[model samples]
Target: MIDQLLDRPITDFIPQREPMVMIDKIITCEGNTITTSFLVKSDNQFLSGNRFSESGMLENIAQTAAAKVGYECLKNNEPVPLGFIGSINKVGVVDYALVEQVITTEVIIQREVLNVTIIKGTCMLGDKDLATCEMKIILDLG
Candidate 1:
């Protein structure tokens, strides 16, 4: 069952085709809570000095949230809408994602208010959390 879930890549969900998709794999997903991983490379245009900044970490979380939205929509045969970060809250950078490290991120959808979905997520390099944020993502029709 889990194998079938991760079978399709994140590209099938979100519209990011190239040089933009940040997530590499879905480690585990259960509706509102999803865990994913990304391989950060020096070649990635978004990375600086083989490291992803705190803002980038937030972006990564937002993209991961979109992935969850896409998965649900596809499973229900509905359209996945384009989404944006509505607001940021309690964001902290404990460290930075280094080169050649596959950063794993986990996001939990806490609530939906005023058409915005609230998400709390964390980025980790191994067991150490590199960053964490509570964000609100706004959905817009594509």
Candidate 2:
């Protein structure tokens, strides 16, 4: 419901667990572009559990893209369509972001063929960009 969008961020919506929740809030979403934010806390399970390393910043960018799609479908419409991540490729992490830093990630849809959505994303902490990647996400309802 639209109610969920205001009270809590997308990361807390649905059932994505602690470490897997990769987004904070939707910054800008219109047409085929969406921006979101995330803060990596020292208490994050990934940082604390050793499952995620500093070099995994690209993955965070990809996940932020996922969060954007979910938010777009959830808050902008009635039925709340569901989408899934198909692939993420050509990733590079710039090595500036560290653990417990807030990042602003943006996703722009570059290609959309059929139901597949291909997007380019960048993760930035304030004005500093730390990672970039192109992700192919499979969004289908079936």
Highest lDDT: give the candidate number: 1
Runs of candidate 2 with Cα error greater than 4 angstroms are 1-8, 11-15, 48-56
Quote the lDDT for 19 in model 2: 64
Write the residue-wise lDDT of candidate 1 on 55-130 in tens digits.
6788788888888888888888898888888898998888998878889999999998766899999999999999
Score candidate 1 by lDDT: 0.85
lDDT score of model 2?
0.66
lDDT of 2 by residue, 1-142 (tens): 2434644656543235566666777766667777777777766654635333444465566666666666665665644345666877877766555566777888889988887889998877788877787878776556
Best by TM-score, which number? 1
- Each model's lDDT comes to 0.85, 0.66
The residue-level lDDT of candidate 1 at 124 comes to: 93
- Superposed by TM-score, candidate 2 places the C-alpha of residue 32 at a distance from the truth, in angstroms, of 1.9
User: Which pairs clash in the backbone of model 1?
Assistant: none
